[model samples]
Target: MKKRWVLLVIVAFVAVGCAEPLTKTQKGAGIGTAIGAAAGAGLGQAIGRDTESTLIGAGIGAAVGALAGGSIGRYMDNQEATMRNQLAGVESASIQRNADMLAVTFKSDFWFDINSATLKPGAYTELQRVS
Candidate 1:
């Protein structure tokens, strides 16, 4: 029974490790924005200001921030896809679309030189065209 429990625990740990981890930047931005918004609104209201106006301002600020962040995130994703495709050496690429964004992943060995960060000129040009 002890051996079985040990094996189960090992398997569970391995499964957890295999799961994708959130990047530190993502975690930091999400937590920071939430905390900042709450703090800003609370401070605004504590100064004998209009509560409704404070809340509305916070809501508008959050919406604009979210939109800007999403655009920047998509641009970064495109850059990553370009790099991956250049390194992948594949003939064609596939895109996975989410509700508001797309993920492009490729398969092929022709995309990059071994252990090299520099992309082929052709690959760079192609990626530019796609973007």
Candidate 2:
């Protein structure tokens, strides 16, 4: 109950942009910690039904989740920059980052032969760049 209220207040403040802005890493940590804490508490209650267990679960979850989240965010940032630099002149492919995942989309029209399912000769070059 107390944790929920504190989370709500923090979310409201962030939503309204009243507080100093959060970087992607900071945002990831906050989100991961909140989600992990909730999951941990629920699991602890289901397994142990004890206060000590719940507190321990929450603490462990918060630490692991925050570090993992920050690391993922940083990895995505670096990958996005690399993709943009590597594919600078290639207009047929697009790269997207959603949360911790990266989506690389290539237009078939740019990579495929007309009326055939064969990959164009030049497409290999772009694919090699990506690799």
Candidate 3:
């Protein structure tokens, strides 16, 4: 009985966490859920030495972890929005978000010449403006 319930819960969580096309919040939540479940299961086993207690603890931990992870993802989303707005006018530049990191790519057309290692004259002004 207790074993079945624990297995069911674990399976359900794994299904959700393994789903594809996940948003940032969902990705974070999935990671959090896995970590929280492992920690909770360990603590439950240590304290109660029972499957039922493990299930309950895992459920609680998963919920808390999801909330925390979602909050962080939301913050990152907002930060990306702000960065996009700030860099909207940058020439030949593109912004890319990789999880918690932001990548900015500037084309060399405005910064350098083909097969040249020296910076173009306009590049100085552009760099100043960006800085």
Candidate 4:
């Protein structure tokens, strides 16, 4: 039983940890799964009073929680894609998405003249499109 719990924990961590940081939906799912598993295990222990029931409850809860959280940041995903498409031809800017955050960076030299603080005339059109 202890070994099973340890394996389950390891698997959960592995599922949540990947080379790239998780998006909002993935993050939500991981959080939901952990919470659901704990709640289910507690309920199962209280109600069914058996190890088998606890395990079954945990599995069911995890699945439900994952499904519920799957679309948490879907709108952000669409917006990011749209922004990428709109900025496709621009060579002076770049976008980076990390989890629920979206960052857009523009080259200062492209938008400004040397060390001047004012944006170049051509930069307005690009900025307007972004807005």
Candidate 5:
């Protein structure tokens, strides 16, 4: 069993190393799979000493985690596209996404008056609609 596990690991490493570069979603899934496998192995060992239990746990964890991670990437892609379209012709705001988080940044010059912390007059209405 230990040899089998070692062989599996070697095979997996070789396969991935020989493969083409992964996309963002694929990278997310790979990260998820690693995390999930570790968690599953820990849980499996705590519950039982058998390989079957470990494999089952790992499978379930990988499936759930991969789906979640990949879906999040896809969702971010969709949102970024939407944001780009929505902000078209409006250069003051920009949207950025990395992994699971999204950020929308607005140029301070557009919202604040010079040398003042207070918002410029009529800024509230446009900002409200954007938000």
Candidate 6:
């Protein structure tokens, strides 16, 4: 009976360890892609394209958005490490697993230009290096 109980406990532990954790990055990407696709489709329709064109545009936009988000996540991870080293006063940073990918979120103040969604030249350079 004791041996059976021990085996059950071990099995439970293993199950817990093997369970997949939910990932915010994956969720964000999915939501972002959906929104982007909708917006793309709307724009395509306004421009007098057919349903087929709208769908194609949506697919392309979703792919590009996912790639951009993934790239930005990686860049932020690297930037966090660099900042930690240089500042030495900042909190430790970590990259979380997101499905088969890795992700990191950054403070908006750290990476973006004021009133602009476009990446700064330095940020673009870093992203290029990453790619």
Which sections of candidate 3 miss by over 4 Å? 1-20, 98-100, 112-131
Q: Write the per-residue lDDT of candidate 3 for residues 1-131, one digit (tens) a residue.
A: 99999999999999979978766677788788888888887888788899998988888878888888877777777877877876788867789877669998999877889999999987887677655
Supply the TM-score for candidate 3. Answer: 0.64
Per-residue lDDT of 1-131 in model 5, one digit per residue for the tens? 99999999999999979999666677777778878877887788678788988888888778777887787656656776777777665677887765456678889999998899999877787676566
By lDDT, is 3 or 5 better? 3
TM-score of 6: 0.40
Residue lDDT tens for model 6, 1-131: 99999999999999979978534455456666776787778777767578887887788778767666656555655665654444343232234544545454445554477898876665655444333
* The candidate that achieves the highest TM-score relative to the unseen native structure: 3
Instruction: List model 4 lDDT by residue over 1-131, tens digit each.
Output: 99999999999899868558666767778887887888888888888999999998888888877776665555556788899997888998899986567889998998999869999999999998876
Candidate 6: residue pairs that collide:
none
**What lDDT, from 0 to 1, does candidate 2 have?**
0.80
Model 2 root-mean-square deviation:
5.5
Using TM-score as the measure, what is the rank order of every candidate, best first?
3, 5, 4, 2, 6, 1
Q: How big is the positional error of residue 23 in model 6, measured in Å on the Cα after superposition?
A: 6.7
lDDT of 5: 0.78
TM-score (C-alpha) between model 2 and the true structure:
0.58
lDDT of all the models against the reference? 0.61, 0.80, 0.81, 0.82, 0.78, 0.62
**lDDT of model 4 at position 33:** 84
Weakest 10 consecutive residues of candidate 3 by summed lDDT: 122-131
Off by over 4 Å in 5: 1-24, 97-103
Residue 16 of candidate 5: its Cα lDDT?
79
Expressed as tens digits, the lDDT of each residue in 22-61 for candidate 1 is 4333534455556556655765576548988678656655
Worst 10 residues of 2 by lDDT: 18-27
For all candidates, the clash counts are 7, 0, 0, 0, 0, 0
